[model samples]
Target: MRFLGNFLTNSSRRHAAAILSAAAFAGASSIGFAAPALAHDAVLSSQPEQNETIKQLPHEIILNFSGEPQQGFNTISVSRDGNVLFRGEPRAKGQELILDVPDNVRSEPGEYTVGYQITSSDGHATRGGYQFTVDNPDSSAAAEGSDDAKADTTATSTEGEQGESNSSVPSWLLPVGGIVVIAGALVLAIKRYRDIKKD
Candidate 1:
């Protein structure tokens, strides 16, 4: 009888350990499944579209995103060659970040890039750029009323960097969930061990 009790106790310990291992595995799997959602927002489409050539720059530069970007700390900059032609704050509307191009800003026929930094819906800062060509041979290369164009490129850059540093959400919630699962498993195993002792 003494030997049998010892064997049963050992078997019960193995069973409890198995349950703990299974719970840990399940928690890890759940974190893996959630990894994709941890990614920041991305641009789904834009006004000019990537690499598209157009005769004229639109009055509004629109960027459609996969998620609704939050309001504030949003910027749009249009550049050609090394020159920043336009840089300004953009308004967020649902999933769209819209920049109303100032009438004074003009572009020459060449490749242009639209760079953006916005507060993503998940509260993380997201930055990206896309290029489009302007084939408007009739338009002048120099931006008209150059003196009127906002020369706040440095400020915009600084603000964007600050926003990125400030708006971070913890990338991993796995440790907390894993701990909970392990704790629960331990509690369950303890209860089972007590029940076996009583039996």
Candidate 2:
């Protein structure tokens, strides 16, 4: 009975050890699966966050990441219906990247698609984008405004160049005009002198 008891006791201990070993392995595997999540750079937060709505447009978009992303290869852009409203050159500060939205956007009310691409701390490239909305869905005004802005820009540039050219014209014209006038007067005087002398 004593020998049998000892054998049973040893067997129970061996079984418990086996169970503990399996549990340890399972815990390690779960941790291994979670490691990849941390290894990759992910969006921690953002301005105009995913699915957020706003009343007005902003001059820039911002992103915060779980890890520090590499610089010189990051980009941020905002668009509507594939027409880009703003594309900013990403400026990285630690784990955050700030991008400027061009003023031409004029905060038109519509759904905007914000896209981003960056090199992660792990040397991997990450690409993603999200959509946001402005309460005013009347993009027609914004569209018209943008067109008018473009026309204004074109007109301004044309005016600027024309102004420069126009301002410079009289400078050269006065000299040439004076020379022609003086030459004509001299010719007329000589003709009169010869005619009078002949008479």
Candidate 3:
């Protein structure tokens, strides 16, 4: 009986050690899997920063990232009232991505959204967006009882005549989708670990 007890105790210790080793490996693997995504370049700052209000529309919109963004397949789009007014590839300069507003692109905006997608220096695609307001009092001149009201009306009409573009996908879609995929993978790994533990 004493010999049998010793063998069973040794087996339990071995089994517990195996589980501990597996848990440690799984923890390490999860961290490794998520490291790249977490290290992807982040926006350090923007010219027309999030929720900022400016007196005039900037000629160029600039986004500064934590690391230099890779060129190609990069996009920056500006929108107001659900209409995309400008959408184009930005000029990548060091850690800054700049989008020049077209000479003909005029805006009388209350709030505008700047959305972007860029190849991260870490080689992953990252996307995000921010909002800024253009509270140019001159924009509302057409509604005022002033001599220049008629001219303002004509300008507003011209702006309307220059039809707007629409963005089909949200800028945050990629990052959000990546997060979901990663979460699912981690859940699957954990489920497999639980099955092994059961055995």
Consecutive 10-residue window with the lowest summed lDDT within model 1: 141-150
TM-score of 3: 0.63
Off by over 4 Å in 1: 1-26, 29-37, 140-199
Which lDDT value does model 3 have at 199?
100
If the candidates were sorted by their lDDT against the true structure, best first, what order would they fall in?
3, 2, 1
What is candidate 1's TM-score against the reference?
Answer: 0.59
Off by over 4 Å in 2: 1-38, 137-199
Error of 2 at 177 (Å): 49
Across residues 1-199, which tens digit of lDDT does each residue of candidate 2 receive?
9999999999999999999999999999999988765587988899988899998877678899999998778888889867987676788899999987776667766788989999888778898989998876457777789999999999999999999988876678899999999999999999999999999
* Alpha carbon lDDT of each predicted model: 0.87, 0.87, 0.89
Global CA lDDT computed for model 2:
0.87
Tens digits of lDDT, candidate 1, 98-175: 899888876568889999998888788889999999897455533443433445666788899999987774657668
Clashes of each: 0, 0, 0
After superposition on all CA atoms, what RMSD does each candidate show versus the true structure? 46.2, 11.1, 40.4
TM-score of each: 0.59, 0.51, 0.63
